[model samples]
Target chain A: MTDATATRPSIAGEQRIDGSDLLGDVEFLVARVRAIGSGHAREALAPFGLRVRAYAVLSLACGSVSPTQRDIADFLQLDPSQVVAVIDSLEASGFVRRAQHPRDRRVNIVEATEQGLATYAEAREAVSRARDRSLGSLSAEERETLTSLLLKVAF
Target chain B: MTDATATRPSIAGEQRIDGSDLLGDVEFLVARVRAIGSGHAREALAPFGLRVRAYAVLSLACGSVSPTQRDIADFLQLDPSQVVAVIDSLEASGFVRRAQHPRDRRVNIVEATEQGLATYAEAREAVSRARDRSLGSLSAEERETLTSLLLKVAF
Candidate 1:
C-alpha cells in the first residue's frame, strides 16, 4: 500500500515558515476551527435531521426567551430569509411553533414544543460531546481561557 | 426619528441568562467570531475585488508552497468545487494561474503571478488593518494569547 498519510499535504507544515503568518491570523484561525467544529456537529446532528444552522435556531428557540424570526436572524447573524426557512422546517416537523409574543403582540415568537425541547436536550448532549472531542487537545482551563478571549473579540 | 439601534435585538441580551449557556459554547463562540470577522473582512476586501473565501485561496496561493487545488481545498476546509470556482475567478482576474507541479506531473499547481503577488501584498495589508480594527477591544497581549490558543485548536 502507498503511504497515504505521507502524501497528504499538511496545512501546518505548509504554513509554518515564520509561525506568525497568514495561518496564525485570528480570522483565519477562527474560520478554520469553526469549519472543523461545524463538520463534527453536522455529523452528530445528522440523526436528528438537523444541520448546524437549523440547530442554532433550535437552540435559540429552546432558550428562556421566545425568539422571533427577526430575533433569530439578528442573534445568529443570519439573514431573515434564511431564519424563516429554518423556522419553517422546524415548524413543519412540529418541533417549533409560531406564537404571539405575550409582551409584544406584533412580533411572532418562535417557541419550542415539548417534543422540540426533548429533541434539543438530546441534540445538545450530542453536540457537546462532538465539540469536546474536537477540542480534546485542550485542557478545561485552556478551553475556558479560549472562550473568554473569543468572547472579548466576538461581542 | 426612529431609534433604529433600539429596535435591534441584541444577541448578548438574548442569551445572558446564567452568564454561561449554549452561546458560551466554544464551537458557538468560534462560529460567532468567524461571522463577525468575515463581515469585517468582506467589507475591507470588496475594493480589492475579493471576498473572504477568495482571499483565503489567494493567501494560500501566495504562500511559499505552490498549492494544488486539492491542497487549497484541504487546508481551507472548503469543497474542492468551491476552491475550483474561486481559483477560476482569481485566474480570470489575472491574480493567479495554473502551472504544472514539478514534483507531481499529475497535479496542477496554483501559483501567483507578479501582479497577483502585488495585489495580494496590498490586500493582506488591508485585511490586517480590518482584522486589527475588529479586534481593537482586546489588548495586544490578549490578542497574542487568543491567536496562540486558536492556533492550537485550529491546527
Candidate 2:
C-alpha cells in the first residue's frame, strides 16, 4: 500500500506531530490540510445528501432574511451562475424556494425551507464534529491561534 | 449596477482581509479558497502556456527522482485520475515526459524537461507573489500557525 492509504487510519489520530517545521511553504501546507478536512466533511455530509457547497448556501440562507441568489453567492464566494445552479438543485429538492424580489422583478429572493433549516442544523453538527476530529491534535491555544491566522490570511 | 456588481469589489477585498476568521468551517473554507486561488493562478499561467496544476506537476517531477504520477497525486492531495489529466496536459505541452517504469510495468514515471523547469521557476515566483498579496494582512506568526493548522487539517 502507498503512504496515502497506509496513513488513512491515522488521519485524525491523537498525535502531536509537527510537519510544519520541515516544510518551508505555509500556503501549500494550508492547502493540503484544508483538502483533508474537506474530504472528511464531505464524507460526513454525504449521508445527509448535502455537498459541501450546498450546505454553505443553505447555512447562509438560514441566517439571511429574504436574500437574493446573488447575496448567497457573494457570501459564499461563488459565481453568480454557480449560485443559480445550487439554487436550482436545492429548489428541485424542495430544500429552498425562490420568490420574486419585492422591489425588483429582475432579482429572485432565496429562502431556505423549514426542512432546509433542520437539515442545516444537522449538517452543521456533523461538520463541527468533523472539524473537532481534524483539529484533535492541536492544543486549545493552537486552535485559537490557527483560527486567528486563517482569518488573517483570508480577510 | 445590480447588487451583484456593487458587492463584487468589497466581497473580493473582504475575502482577502478576513480569510482566517471566516475559516470557521475548515473544509469549506479550504475548498473555496483553493478553488479561488487556483482559478487565479490558472488565469495567470494561461498566457505562459501552463495551467496551475501542470506547473505543480512539473515542479514535482523536476525536484524528485523517479516519481510516479501516483506519487505526485499523493503528495498534492489530488485524485490519481486528476493527476493523470494534469500530467496529460504537461506531456502534451512538451514540458514533461512519461516513460515506462523500468522496474514496475504497472507504473509510469514522470520527468520534467529543461523547458519545464525554466517555466516552473518563473511560475513559482509568480505564484509566490500572488500568495503574498493574498495573505498580506497575516503576520509571520499567523502564517506559521495557518500553515500548521492547514497541514493538520489535510492529514
Candidate 3:
C-alpha cells in the first residue's frame, strides 16, 4: 500500500523488502560467492576424497602453523566439533598424526603425515584451479585487488 | 624434506604445504568472511527466530519479484531441496504463502504475508547492524570499493 511504502525504504520499483537490497548487499554477495566457490572446491577435491573444509585443515597441518585443533577452529571460524570431525577423518585415513603439544600437552598438535603431505600437494593444485575459476571474470589486477581488500577486511 | 621442497612450491621456510597461501587466497578469504558474517547475521536474527538463510528467503518473498522456489534457489545458488525446506518452514510460520504461479501453475510463487513483511523490517535492521559490524576496519570508501569489485566479479 502507499502508506507502507511511505513508511519504509523502497527500491527499484518493487519486490524490495525493508530497504535491504540483496543483490547490492555486499554481505549477501559474499555469502553466495562462498557457496559457489566452496561447491567448486569440493567438487575439484572429490577425487581425493577430501571436502573443501578437510582440505583446508590438511593445508594448515601441512604448514608450519603447527596448530592445535582449537587454533584451527578459531582461525577458520569453525565450531570445535566440526574441526574435530575433520581431524578424526584425516587421522583415520592416516593422512595426519596428532600429538600432544610439547609446550602444552593438554592440547593436541595436528601434523601431516608423509602421505598426507603428498595428497595435499596434488590437492593444492586442484584447489588453486578452483580459485582461478571462482575469481571468474576478474582480471589479474582485480584478483589481486579483491584478495588484498578481502584480506584486510576479513582477516 | 629437501627432496620434497625441491620438487614442489614452497612458502615461508617451514611446514609450508605446496605454494598456496591460505591468507592470500581470495577464495578462502571470501569463504571466511561469509562464515563470519553469516554467524553474526544468524545471531542478530535469532531473536526473530530466523536464520540468515531463512531471512534471506523471506526477504525475497516480501518483495515484488514474486519468485518461485526454483528461482529463489537459483538466485541464492542453493540446492532446490534447501530452498524447498525454507519455503515450507516460512509457510508454516504464517510468514509466507505459496501459490501457483499465475502464468505457470505447475510452479509455486512465494509471497509474504503482512506479518512477514513486518518481521522482515525488524530482522532487516538487525542484519544491517551485523553488516556494519562485519565490515569493521574498512572505511566507507573501502566498503564501496569492496562491494563494487565483488559485484563485478560475482554478479
The reply for model 1, stretches above 4 Å from the true place, is A1-20, B1-20
Give the top-scoring candidate (TM-score). Answer: 1
True contacts kept of each: 0.48, 0.28, 0.46
Candidate 1 lDDT, B56-131, residue by residue in tens: 8888788887777887777787789898899999999999999876555776688889988999899999999999
Candidate 1 docking band? acceptable
**Tens digit per residue, CA lDDT, model 2, B1-155:** 43445443322222222222234755666666666566666666777788666666677777636467776776776889999998888888888888876545777778778888888778777777766766778777766667666655555
Task: Please give the ranking of all candidate structures by TM-score, highest first, separated by commas.
Answer: 1, 3, 2
Displacement of residue B28 (Cα, Å) in model 3 is: 1.4
Cα lDDT of all candidates, in order? 0.82, 0.68, 0.80
lDDT of 1: 0.82
Candidate 1, B-chain TM: 0.85
TM-score of chain B of each: 0.85, 0.75, 0.84
Which regions in candidate 3 have their CA more than 4 angstroms from the true location? Answer: A1-20, B1-20
- Show pairs that collide, candidate 3: A15-B63, A15-B64, A63-B15, A64-B15
Q: What tens-digit string does per-residue lDDT give for candidate 1 at A103-140?
A: 56666778899999999999999999998988988989
* Winning candidate number (lDDT): 1
Give the per-residue Cα lDDT of candidate 1 at B70: 82
